[model samples]
Target: MNDQPLSGLTVIDFSTLLPGPLATLMLAEAGATVIKIERPGGEDMRFFPPKSGDVGTLYAMLNRGKRCLELDLKAADARARILELTDAADIVVEQFRPGVMARLGLGADELCARNPRLIHCSITGFGQSGPRAMEAGHDLNYMALTGLLALSRGSFDAPVLPPAQFADIGGGSFPAVINILLALLQRDRTGKGSRLDIAMCDAMFTFALFAQAQLTTLGHAPKNGADLLTGASPRYRLYPAADGHLIAVGALEDKFWQALCDAVELPDLHRDDRRDSEACAAAMAERIASRTAAEWVPVLAGADCCATPLATLEDAFRDPHFLERGLFDFTADADDTPIPATIVPIDRAFRGRAGAIDPD
Candidate 1:
């Protein structure tokens, strides 16, 4: 038997791509029995790029600790088999266009009648009842619609994808997991199931908490890189290194900002709350551009000023803090090939952490 918190819970994951798979993987790591019902051909992400000779690193990493079964979901037999599996499942997640589930007679209304204790979650680009519910979209599309793309908009004329999957995985999938878990807890008292309709576009809007707060109170929304937190202030922006590398800075609080100025030998910076911020920013940028990433990394680390050199994904894996905290785990595939995975940060002493899951 597994020793994890969710050891006995069974999850039927009928979703695809990063979002759904990632959410289920977290549950699997918590020792839940997560069964991945892939389409007849295979998981969609199996064909995603950056293949390792022929294997998908992403697919392997996300599907760990889960059994994959191929099923033609449109087939009658597949629907019946799905119902059979979901009947015994504690939770079900399906990321499809809104009406597809109902068309297949597998809607939450029907599923809950079959299993009253089930937590059925539906993740889609738009909500189940929205006017745009049937319109197809990706992460960028949702971010664009929700006005979140400007959070990372660059100076270049071209648009680029955000380094992270903010909408699909962050908004849609993770929210589904959190809500489903909440529903499960509620089931203990209410003894009933519920349906969760997670719209990625709607989820994208929540990403603007601080910006929205500013808009509400200040009566004006800032543009790309013009907001205080978005790089308008010298203390909260990135600087390019001499070697084309970047250093991120975020000395926001007064104390932190004071420390940063002290570390940079610019103690005068503390006195000028309205000092030509643009000029200061320009000076800081030029100063940072004088050194390679190697020369400034140690200086920033010693300053406690919330400034650090940006590292690429591969190099980021070697960061000592994450290593010490067990953020990365290595697993072996069926052929004994090494599969590197990112372990959830939950720990025995995680209570002090704000977003840590509660223990029963």
Candidate 2:
């Protein structure tokens, strides 16, 4: 039996950066034949810094297991080639502005009309028909517009920039992949296909579920840093050790909280954090700062508390747990050298071979 779910499917990807490329990458990993179409000089991401030989590491990581084709889409011959490819494709993913593809005669309407069974997905910041559809924006702008950034402000002076592109991957790529799969399933049932407009901003509102609940109950959401999960409670915040390393505390339940309090030897007066949350947090912070992360590791290890020392990227890459799980088993080739492939959330049973690289 075939392990790859999308074994015989074909995907034509016109996405330049993270969202579209990532969606197609997931499809490719699931055994789809993904053909990435780039402009003459290739996409802007190809020129991004930190290159591996001639290709950018970011671009190589995302575009692994996909075929490449360069074409000037504005030219007549290019449009003809795309239409021909659309005739045989199962899915087409694009991340252009609202009317850009339409102006180039490569819009979903034109392509779907030709194939009638193509699952066309368009990923954009705002959407296809909204007033802001034509406006230029990135991941940060999408988060800011969706009120997600306001929930976890860093300080009064400036808001914190997220370490990852939540809106781009969570909102855009994930939704696009999910809907494309759904569309494919639906097409199997009814001999027809559909167009999906995946607005990155529209999906980010779901990430604000906690804030929305507070807003519904109290007519307004809690201010930044005041929410229970956002540093208000000592049980669910990051505490710094004497060595300046941070420990992520997630002892939300009573049992875990009690375990954490006992392990840290927190005072009885500050144990009942409900009485004075700020004072309790301050006391806990003081205790955590008294010892270095290394000294506290063994004490917290057997406590059964959810607290853990924050691991840097380098540390995480070398973590024994992840290595035992074979998270980096697969490798993508860059300059003919094998680099660890970006691991997606697909089950190993449904993914491609562990050591397989994309064929040229």
TM-score of each: 0.90, 0.96
**In candidate 2, which residue ranges exceed 4 Å CA deviation?**
353-360
| Per-candidate local distance difference test | 0.77, 0.89
Candidate 2 residue-wise lDDT, 207-281, digit = tens: 888888999999998787778888788999999999999999999999999999999999999999999988999
Q: Please state the error at residue 173 of candidate 2 in Å.
A: 0.9
Candidate 1 on 163-183: residue-level lDDT in tens? 888897779767877897888
Full-model lDDT, candidate 2: 0.89
Against the true structure, candidate 2 reaches a TM-score of 0.96
**Looking at candidate 1, what is the lDDT of residue 328?**
59
lDDT of 1: 0.77
Query: In model 2, where is the ten-residue run with the lowest total lDDT?
Result: 351-360
Clash number for each model: 0, 0
TM match of model 1 to true structure: 0.90
